[model samples]
Target chain A: MNSEIVAIDDWNVPHKKSDGVRNRKDYLERLLKTERNMKDDAEPLVSWGFHHYFHGELTRQDLDLISKDRPILIIHRSFHEFIMNSRALSLFNITEDDLNHLSKEEKKFASLEEGHFSERGLIAVMPKVMKYLAAPQRLITGLQITENYFQENGITLIANPGSMYNPSIQKVKNYVFGDEDTPFKSLFIPSALYMLEHTDISNLLKTTEDHLSWGEGKVGFLPKHIKLFTDGAMYSQNMVLRDGYLDGHQGAWLMENDIFREAFKLYWDAGYQIHVHQNGDSGLDRLLDVLDENMKRNPREDHRTTVVHFGYSAFDQIDRMKKLGVIVSANPYYVSVLSDLYSREGVGYERSQQMVRLGDVDRAKIILSLHSDMPMAPASPLVLMHAAINRINYAHEVAGPNQRISALTALKGVTLNSAYVLGIENDYGSISPGKYANLTVLSDNPLSIDPLKIDKINVEATIVEGRPFK
Target chain B: MKNFIFVIALISFNVFSLCSNDRILVAKELVTLDDLYQDANAVYIKGNKFHSIGSKEDLIKKFPNIPVDHLYKDSVIVPGFIEHHVTSTASCNNNEF
Candidate 1:
């Protein structure tokens, strides 16, 4: 069998055997493979020495190949890089003296200072050092970014419920083959709720019915479940858990039960599962009651109703969830950003210790997955993995060490658990054959590394559909 | 005669009250919202048009005789979700594609 040489050690991502020259050449090759799915033919793999945009020599890509498949590495080109084509060079108005690798602290200061492409500058500028592109180009970049980020953290898939492009599922169904932005391992489908709500439920159902008429299997509208939110996030102190709030307040209920029931009845009758975002334990209880009323007709186990962010689901509620078969999707994102807030809520006492109860979640055997809940947090699986494994404060002290999970379990949350949660378990998750080739190449084996240094590991490559995006 | 009619009405009420309601879904995990949902809740067909809110125990006291409803038990229940400004399902009848 023909083989591709991949750095199984330090760099883990794929590359062609270089004819001679090295450095950034393999990185460039992988980037090409990510943009254009498969390679029709091989090209001369020349060695391109490393260019940090900082020290030593400026970099170069053999100025030999220029095809439709090869758009200029528009983002990586800088004024100093000698081999950059005229088009790539024209994009950047800076020089080598002006370009230097930014230290973590220096980058922070630059964000505040604003001059010479430093902290106070437009960090989003396409050229400084490979800035992420937004649109038209977004799909290409987005897919690679998502693929790389997920793989490095062992996340096989991300079930994206909503996106701007697929406003309604018809648009998603109409999608031809693939989207560049979708670097996800399997199908990143449009959600049912996104289409149903806001539109007349009748019209939405009609659309659903019309689409389903196309027959079963693939390439048609897929309705996993309709998502509903019971209340606000716990980070904001707005969950409706049973024993009231941590404070003396009763969290607000966004919707009245009766109104919720009507929506449920309509959708349930029409055939759809409910995936609700219920943060507080009390909020979960309220949602379960509604599901119970409809239980005579709607069964929980087969229906696969889900509850997210059950930050304070009590031990008793957790037990009930086990019998009911309600899956829990936690924002492991909470391990960072919002940690101290929950920890200090009790004034010196670790409130988060009491808040995020992992033991309750693990004991339920509920299908559990971790996520960044991005925008609130950055979309990195390792960050979530680190949080789930550590369950500690920033000072490296374990916040709820007793409730911490193993690095292996944390990996599953991002990989197997997440793939199932996204409803693409069959394709993503493992290194299985006949599945879409989505892989994450980590600089170090997570199993071998110290758990605390997990987040510090470098991502060598993020592969999507067998192509590497390095 | 009026007293006789009143007595008949009372007897009918007693007969209805005597009938045991359907059993509530009892489980190790019961988050009965019998409190948030009350007897005064408006009913349409069989759906609660407007649920009166209360806690599990409180609602149990209010309707102790009636079989408790386990519809909202143990699960997170939000009242109503309305997605506004998001994409609405509409066909592009303009099959120009």
Candidate 2:
């Protein structure tokens, strides 16, 4: 994932003052102008990066002003919810009659009057929308750019823990990322959530086993690796918290607790390394409980069940993680961008500053890795290391000084430890004999440099399999 | 005398053949991140794997005829970075049309 392409949307409208779109009026005008400029009138106007906090709550009525004729779908920044205008509803052939067929729980996520969809509701409409979103040429173009972006940032390998299971999309990915010319290799870890939604429960293991053959050249699936989700996105403040939000809003669960437990057990019994997308303390608590229960019922050593995006973890949770043998792949950029604002509005000063507490994780002697979550943060290892080491927030103040880690530890979080998290350390990671000749040449050593200057270090070139790429 | 000459010739031939394809990468410093050779300044590539790593002089002396690439004489080389998490669908969801 090279860049998150957020179209002319209002998520960052307040932040984009110079773009001449300060409020919803300016945003709507811009959207209308963009729609008018479209050469193909039939093409649905789809945009992403819509946050309710910044853009305010939107409805079909608000969007109808742009065009009641052309279809418009604006995805929430979390990618879990979306709002569609009246024409979009008509274009997708979704009506009140169709919505009436949904279950009570499903109906809660889908509002026909508002033309809004979230979670399961979003999943229900995704097939139709994905045909447009993941079009072959579009994915190919984005992946081509992604290849360059990876090479430019000195990344030799990237693993998508929860990749789409579309064979057509995989073919496109294989065409681009799997090409011999591409400098890096990509490993995919299939999502159990996707399997539950798309395939028969009995065929989950077989379906995952089939993905081993999905790999061609540089793109492949790692065997015995599966991903599951606990809560919603951190960016959208949808992550389920222990004590709820300051404004009395409740966070959402991506997967219900019972379902999450069932999936966790299936994978745990089958000896698969389960990687979970968890953001809040409540989510973590549920995850720990499931893990603890599974360990007691059927003991498995070195499970390496990793918690991805350790968004809001309590200090005690770290001890539990260590005991349960769970590692973490944290996104420190949450502190860099969301700390100040979230402190004031979302979780209060204490929890907000303590987000992505790698220092505590390290002190506990737990294996910690840092990631971009790419479009969630810039897909830059140096930048990730800088954030982890400095703990600097948007306001130039260190959010959690005690949570700051050493430069060497931060470096490992991006390299060796990251490879370890993926269970590919022997083949990749450090510069050693018999491992792939993958080296990232830099202008300065991240370990020896000033912690603040880490992000400024230039990537001179990259050597993959003993072949250098600039 | 003939057997002695043949033995010497065989040893020389073996040395030349081994060094023929090897390329010594000599940098000012090598952050090998390996326990045994943690602070080495040079590494010789045999095919696509590191054959040996040590000081520049030691590597050259050990593998005499191997060609040396000093392009990164001023740079630091670390393991190629690994990105542990990324969603391909999220990346391809660039609906910026």
Candidate number of the best TM-score: 2
TM-score of chain A considered alone, across all candidate predictions:
0.60, 0.92
Using DockQ, give the best candidate's number: 2
Global CA lDDT computed for model 2: 0.81
Candidate 1: where is the Cα deviation over 4 Å?
A: A1-156, A162-182, A185-197, A200-204, A207-221, A246-250, A269-271, A346-351, B1-97
lDDT of each: 0.44, 0.81
Which lDDT tens digits does candidate 2 get at residues B3-95?
999999999987886655468887776887788888798888787777788889998998887888899999999888998887655754442
Candidate 2 share of real interface contacts? 0.69
Worst 10 residues of 1 chain A by lDDT: A1-10
lDDT of 2 by residue, A1-470 (tens): 32223432212111122132324565666666777887877878776556666566789998897788878888766677878899988777776665565578777888878989887666667677677667787788777776777788888889988877778888988999888888888999888777777786678889888888998998999989999999888877888998889999777778878788888898899999999999999999999999999999999998899999999989889889999999999999889877876898778999999999999999999999999876576678998999999988767899989999998888888888999899998888888888888889999999999888998999999988788899
Per-model TM-score, in order, reads 0.51, 0.90
In the range A206-280, model 1's lDDT, one tens digit per residue, is: 654444343222223345445555654453455565655344744544444665667667666656756676767
- The lowest-lDDT stretch of 10 consecutive residues in candidate 2 chain A is A9-18
